[model samples]
Target: MSEIVIRTASARQGDIARRAEAMGVDDVFISDLVETFYARVQANETLGPVFEAAIGDEWTPHLHTMKQFWSSIALNAGTYGGRPIPAHHKHLDKIKSEHFSIWLALFAQTLHDIAPSPEAAAFFLERAERIGENFQSILFK
Candidate 1:
C-alpha cells in the first residue's frame, strides 16, 4: 500500500514537471526568476534592510540555494534539502508578519516581468503563496 502511494505521488510529480515544461519552465527560467526577484528584493527599501541583516554581503550562496528551492518546488527536481523554517526563525527578531506580503508582492511583480507565460507565472505564484502561508503559520506561531 505504501508502495502504491509512493508510485502515485511520483507519477503526480512527473506530470507537474511535464506541465511546467509545456509552459516553458526550466532550470534557466528558475535561475532567472531567482536572480530577478532577489535583485528586486535588494532594491526594496523595506525588504532590503531585513535581508541585508540576514544575509550580510554574501548573496551568491543564498541565490544558489533559492534557485534550488524553486526548482524543487516547481519541478519536483528534489535538489533542495535545506531547512527553511529554521533559517527564517534565525531572523525572527527582524522578520515581521507584514514582510510576507511585501515579499509576495515583489515575487508577483518579478513573475509578471519574466515568466515565460501566464500559466507559468500562475504556477509559480501559486506555489509562492502556499510557501508564504506555511512559513507564516510556523514562524508566527
Candidate 2:
C-alpha cells in the first residue's frame, strides 16, 4: 500500500495525501470517524468533561458537524461549513490549552485504535496539532 501512498510536501501547507488515502475507507467515513472519535473522547479522562459540557445532549449536531468537517478535510467534499470559532467562543472561557492538547492526544490514540495506518493516522494527528494550535492562539489572545 506504501506504493499507493503519496508523501505530503508540507503539513503546514495543507498536506492531504494521507487524508485522501484514508477517504477510500468505505465502512468508515466522516460519520464513523465522528461516532468512534466521540466515544473515545467521552471515555477519556482529560477531554471528556470539556466536550460533554460544551456538547451536552447536543452531541448529535456536533457529531454531524464533525462528519462534515472530516469529510471536507479528507474527501475534499466541502460538506463541512460550520464556524467552530463562534461555537468555541461561547464556552471558551472554561477551556484551557491543555484541553486542546489532550483532545488531540485522545484523537490520535483513537485513530490508531480504529485502523492502523502510518500515513493516514499521522496526517490526522498533524492536522489536529495545527488546528488545535490555532484554537489555542485564539483562546490566549
Candidate 3:
C-alpha cells in the first residue's frame, strides 16, 4: 500500500540521518564548510572575481542559502527549497566552465581542513562532485 511505502521511505531517511549524525555531519559542520569554502572562493584569483560579480557585497544571504543547501544535501534536512538551476542561470554570464573545477578544489580543501572525519569529508565531497558535474552538464549544454 501507499501508506506502507511512505512509512518505509520515511524510515530509510531517518536511518540515513542517524548515520550522518554519527559521522559528525551536523549544522555546525555544514556552516563551517560553507563559510570556509566561500572564504577560499573569495580569495582565489580565478573564482573571486566571478563570485564578486554575481554576488556583489551581499554575501550573508548567499552564505545562509549555501549552508541550507549543503545541509539538505548531506543531512537530508529538507532545508533548501531554492531553484538552483535558475539561480545559477542568472549568473551564467559570469560562471565559466573552468570555475567549477576551481570551486570543487576549494571545496575539497575546505573539507580536508575542517571535516571531523574522513568519512564526513568523503560524504560531502561525493555530493559536491556530483552537484558540480550535474551543473556543468546542464549549464554548459
Residue 95 displacement (Å), model 3: 0.9
Q: In candidate 3, how many Å is residue 115 off?
A: 0.5
lDDT of all the models against the reference? Answer: 0.95, 0.73, 0.91
Pairs in steric clash, model 3 = none
Weakest 10 consecutive residues of candidate 1 by summed lDDT: 1-10
TM-score of 3: 0.91
- The C-alpha TM-scores of every prediction are 0.90, 0.78, 0.91
Candidate 3 per-residue C-alpha lDDT over 1-141 given as tens digits, one digit per residue, 9 for 90 to 100: 355444677898899889988889889988988988999999999999999999999999999999999888888888899999889989998998989999999999999999999999999899899999999999999
- Return the candidate ranking by lDDT, descending: 1, 3, 2
The Cα RMSD in angstroms, rounded to one decimal, for candidate 1 relative to the true structure is: 3.2
The global Cα lDDT (0 to 1) of model 3 is 0.91
Per-residue lDDT of candidate 2, residues 91-121 (tens digit) = 8766887787778877887778764466667
Per-residue lDDT of 103 in model 3: 93
Q: In each prediction, how many residue pairs overlap at the backbone (N, C-alpha, C within less than 3 A)?
A: 0, 0, 0
Residue-level error in angstroms, candidate 1, position 28:
0.6
Q: Which ranges in model 3 have alpha carbons more than 4 Å from their true place?
A: 1-10
Winner by TM-score between candidate 2 and candidate 1: 1
